[model samples]
Target: MDTTSDRSRQWQWPQWILRAAAIYNLVWGTWVILFPHHLFDWTGVARLNHPGIWQAVGMIVGVYGIGYWIASSNVLRHWPIVLVGFLGKIFGPIGFLGAALRGELPWSWGATILTNDLIWWLPFAAILYGVFKIHSDPASRIPSVTRGSLEQAADAILPRPQSSNGKSIDSLSRDQPILLVFIRHAGCTFCRETLAVLATRLNEIRGLGLEPVVVHMSSLEEGERLLLSHGLHDTTHISDPGCVLYRHYQLERGTVSQLFGPAVWWKGFQAAILRGHGVGRLSGDGFQLGGAAIVDQGRTVQVFPAANATTSLPIASELRTTLQCAAPIPKAL
Candidate 1:
């Protein structure tokens, strides 16, 4: 792929747009972190029993501000970050509307939504549109002169990445079959649900002779923190900020219907609000889809690619049923 640096010079407004967003997020997050209950008081909502939980949410937003600041240098190359932020901005208000209708929250709460989410919609959308046009243009597309196949993927063009705990996938699964679970950015509620689900089913998964190896697109440090909260920080995880492994496995970027469809909205609400897997800001590639595979000896046995953002992560029984027809597993651990 050609370097986006030269192409990035073609655009100017996106840089400023992203920088402004970064500054706004940083200041807003700082304020919320320092006074977690201030926003609620201003909005006429009762104080929370757990202000620390709200403070943590502010921390997540503050982290996103850092990501936005890094991305401002090359908006075109960092379009995924922008996309995630845009989606969050779009959906944040909708979530607010749902609360207002249920009478659990007051309309006064919208003031923060205006600054934190609504105001950024158009500029963010414009930046995304500009990205779309660039990607749509033939000249802007990276030449396919190089081979980016799976064979080469296992042997990376750059050095292959290791799991968060300093182990390699080949080393971990060299002897036995492992469940390769590729998840979305750490911020996605579905991603959190996937991790939480896997945490509960760890023993059951090993019972099926498959150890879990998670793949994500967040920095190793952020991945560590996210997984630690779910008690899976010790689980094998690979940090692929560039998503090279994702493309190698043929996981493509999702479309509008795949990501933001009506069904997705309903499932998101249920998973986020009802299921208690609350969402977060963009911590990685927002457009990238996720999947799972059973691998032993460098090849996939059965692939379970997610059809959409909210597709349920397969459970232990589901894996057992699916692996029934596949190769026999060794009983010994």
Candidate 2:
């Protein structure tokens, strides 16, 4: 199970929040380091016995800012950093309360806690909660990949929903080879690119004696609309919002770099901006990853997990070569 994927989803807050937290920490740390007395002066609290300790605390807070900055790159992978920061934010106030009660710290010191720690609690907490929720949900769980024969894997995707007025996946692949195309989302720029390529090469694919079926984590209506827009209305599709088959086939989620790196951004620019295919409303889990497979006679001949969100599907020529290579040789007379 790719826990990172689960982290990426359902927490759609902009990256700027993390960036802002980082900047705030750095500035605040610098201020405290240079003028620890300002806080004491404003709160009317006597200075600490060792003012250097306050400076040391500022240094620690600034280090946390660096952690937050790194986490901004990919919060899911670097979640422990955020967890530590959140804990500090929580404990800072509790420690303050104990000090005030003991007359060791001024009540006004809570104002510093408000600015330095309390404000960040909810957003950080929200991210952690989202992480917990995704892992706990049985429906979205990612099943481990079985290191067994293709026939065993095929069994996992069984009882698959029949395509609109078409045969079940098992039935369709029983007599002929089928290319299973797992799509990321209908609104993805790369997915649009995939649609355009398939629409242009459908005839060539047919000539190679391969049937392509699309699996998406969106409603049937949304899938139909997207395919129709791309002139692929006739493409066979299966809607699996629960991602049951996805997990069964071991299609784990993508990581931060895989989904939103520079390469992905460049490809997206070409697809949506330069190519004039505008982005659409998100129709499925934006973080749900995708891949491809060749299923024949209840057996998987090839599996191609997408390298990233922007990965291109293997073109028809590539699939043809793979099929030719995997085909059984003629038996001796």
Clash count for each candidate, listed in order shown: 0, 0
State candidate 2's TM-score: 0.58
lDDT of each: 0.78, 0.75
Error of 1 at 329 (Å): 16
Deviation from native of the Cα of residue 118 in model 1, angstroms? 20
- Assess every candidate by TM-score: 0.56, 0.58
Q: Which lDDT tens digits does candidate 1 get at residues 236-269?
A: 7888765666665666677778888999999899
- Which number leads on lDDT? 1
* Candidate of highest TM-score: 2
Lowest lDDT sum, 10 consecutive residues, model 1, at: 137-146
Flag clash pairs in model 1: none
Clashes of 2: 0
Residue-level lDDT of model 2, residues 94-159, one tens digit each, is 998999999998887787889888988888887775554455333433333542433353446323
